[model samples]
Target: MMEEDDDVTQGVLLRCLSLYSRGGGCKVGATTSDEFGEIVGKSYKPVCGAQDTSVDCFSYGVEKFRKKNNKKKNFQLQEPNHNNNEMHVFLPDDILEMCLMRLPLTSLMNSRLVCKKWRSLTTTTRFMQMRRDGYYPSPWLFLFGTVKDGFCSRDIHAFDVSFNKWHKIEAEVLKGRFSFSVTSVHDNIYLVGGCSILGKMDRNSSKTHRGVLVFSPMTKSWHKVASMKHARSKPVLGVYKVNSNHLTIKSQHNNFFRTRQRIGGVSDVYEDPHRLSVRRVSRTSFEDQKSKQSKVNKSVKDCRRFLIIAAGGFGSWDEPLDSCEIYDSSSNKWTEIQQLPVDFGVVCSAVVCNGIFYVYSESNKLAAYDIGLGYWARVQTTPPPPQVHEYTPRLVSCDDRQLFMVSVSWCEGDGEIGRRNKAVRKLWELDFEYLTWNEVCVHPDAPMDWNSVFVADKNLIFGVEMFKIFGQVLEFLTMCDVSDPKMNWVHVSKNQVAREMDVSSCVMKSMAVVHL
Candidate 1:
């Protein structure tokens, strides 16, 4: 209710901001003139504000103006054609932004198209960083519906946690009759191998090839990169930062020690980028992917470039895989990892946290594959996550070592639309490092009959709900802090802000923290 009250309050103030500019004044009868300013001021103070003196002086002016003309008047209407400069009231940018802050995130994001001033505010990295930090928001989720006609396309949607609205982005680079395998590392989308279903001119269509396509909302363009070894399907693209050492060459005159510091983590993925190997038969023997094919790529005394893994997403629904493979960029090859036990099977939904990988079984069980130990052990499932609705679980993301997944029980569950989710919606968490799982439940009943879930940071999960097997209609996202037992699971934005999501270009494969 307080949030709703905030919406009403901001609505009234924004109405005033537009009118406040006109000869007509603003009304504070129901809304406090300084209230909105104070709210937005808090969001910008420490970051966007330059100095205390400037901030203080600007704040005072807005407050003074409010006190002078407290009455509300519509901005669109002229105020008796007054020529007096006395009514020329203006507030500093800092204070005005404070009011804007109070408005819901959806309003704030859409404010970009409102006018030049709003566009400037939305596009600025400083304001964006401030928003991310202050709100502890999650990255956006770009989802695509079903694919057909030998052609596949999905909309790119960003779920802004701060504003709680989903925005649709339409772009040309996403056209193809190909399958999608995507992931979000940083704020970008990595779209991997897909064969075109239709057009003869469709690039990479029909034939399987390994070519990587990437999309970053910040840059808003798709770029191609190296290809993979084989044409793969339903590849679960997991993006993680690889920590490498920062190098510094020292002159012979002075003795230098290896910095061992990292040049910084750049985003890379398990791409099937063998643009050269598309339909070609093996130049070398094709080893079964289920075996542990990872040899010590270089075991060099200096650096061990980390390996990224991909597993069990090939074949048709009836013959889904249990095979897994890892790639070492240093070696430029794919190493098939040890397969899971017959019961555990290959992880249907799993994510890497810190350095450990927590892979969830399709059944009610889960296990951790120790990268260092080279073994996969079965873990117990007490509050067994409700059985995965389909072959895959909703999501798998790690918060430190605490893993979070939104599992569904198909026996029964209804979304807000009064339709039953193929699986009943429920929020579940597990501290994988400790082998402990939280049974406490939260809701906004996920808006999915079948949506790929991605870790949207701690206590939050987001995914796409398809209108059909091929059309995406809605996006489901929610935060369940539950730090206070009293708070069950507050719906951040599902039906409310998600209405603006663009489902057309959603490439069912990618996930973002919050749509930029």
Candidate 2:
């Protein structure tokens, strides 16, 4: 049942209990004598009847009243029936939020459908921040898939990493877009500009859409937000929070050819000028543009309260572009920061750990960039020894400033000299104090292709795999607990949702881990 609806029911039940607490006197409009008699009839137990206290009777009356009334028609929670002229319960907004915060996440999500007021109250930035601060809802991972079969769809799914439960989020608003950059601020997911279709278009074409869309999981709905001044696809999205204010930091994509086109080396075939854009979406309303503009200017002027950290990424042309820049949200501008070390190769992926940005490549080599001190250092860890065939290692960040490494290796079979991929989904935790990695546990028989990993605060890791095997696409969600020291990988969920589509054609368009 909807939570807001439950609020009304709870009010009535509380009033009924209060009446029974007062020795079952029926005041006018409080409850009819027949209703009081009926409640009394159900409250008394058969054998222990006369010996029970009035408190027990009140509790029983509450249960019976709830069961009886819930089966009836839906009641308007916000308004009391005027024909009966019964008093309705109402609480201040802050009190209401506090009461709502006690509910589980699933109940809170379903509460959005109760009314517009409930939806707005739960979806506000302030409410989301409160939820995070209170740790009301567990952390969840959102996965979005790319377009396939001539249709663009969000294909998004959510998983509660704490309870190992998969959930559904309404993502109709994310349709018709691919490669959109996704990042989370508190409990909301933001989708930036991307190609509306699969095909490539000219960079100067006006057909490109620079719109920004935001989805609040609490409300299970999406809404449009401020758009970027420049169209960006596959941009690096990061959330910069300073002094309790949030500013979305978007690092513009710089094509390797972007510099070449400027020096007259090539014509304007695919020219997307690289630049940074920072948008403040922490506000609940953007209707007052003039006042908002003034507020934005004031905020930008005080930008020195936070320091910006830049992480280098691989360029579009497969060239190693070591350049990086820092965006000062307060100043409403970006400054070119330190370039990566000269030997930094093509970055495969990156994650923030211990307030340091760690960039890793396909090889075992890694470089660390300090966000506060603005210093770069090559992280020294002993790489696995060379073999006849080498498998690329992947990194995942767990809770409590812990880093994990998933090492991949292969084995050769006998006789026919056939090769079999041996993937040990080992969970290794990094000890920052000692600058060492410790093997927590290993799943030696795990599949080679895990699409994504989500880490929970309890040291449980969720690895999801959606791929094809023997012409049949399969989806597998596995969970393992490193904190237990003896736990093995276990399958939590599986499916064949991509039965009609080839696995190779499916791509993960967007994915983000959010703390609810």
**TM-score for all predictions?**
0.53, 0.61
* Decoy 2 TM-score against native: 0.61
Q: Tell me the deviation in Å of residue 278 in model 2.
A: 36
Candidate 2: pairs in clash: 300-330, 303-330
> CA shift at 177, candidate 1, in angstroms?
4.2
Task: Report each candidate's C-alpha RMSD, comma-separated, in the order given.
Answer: 16.1, 14.2
Worst 10 residues of 2 by lDDT: 270-279
Residue lDDT tens for model 2, 36-130: 01113345221111232121322212222231233333322433455654344443577557655654455454344344555577778788767
lDDT of 2 at 109: 47
Which runs of model 2 end up more than 4 angstroms from their true locations? 1-95, 161-165, 170-173, 191-214, 220-320, 326-335, 384-392, 411-421, 431-436, 450-458, 496-506
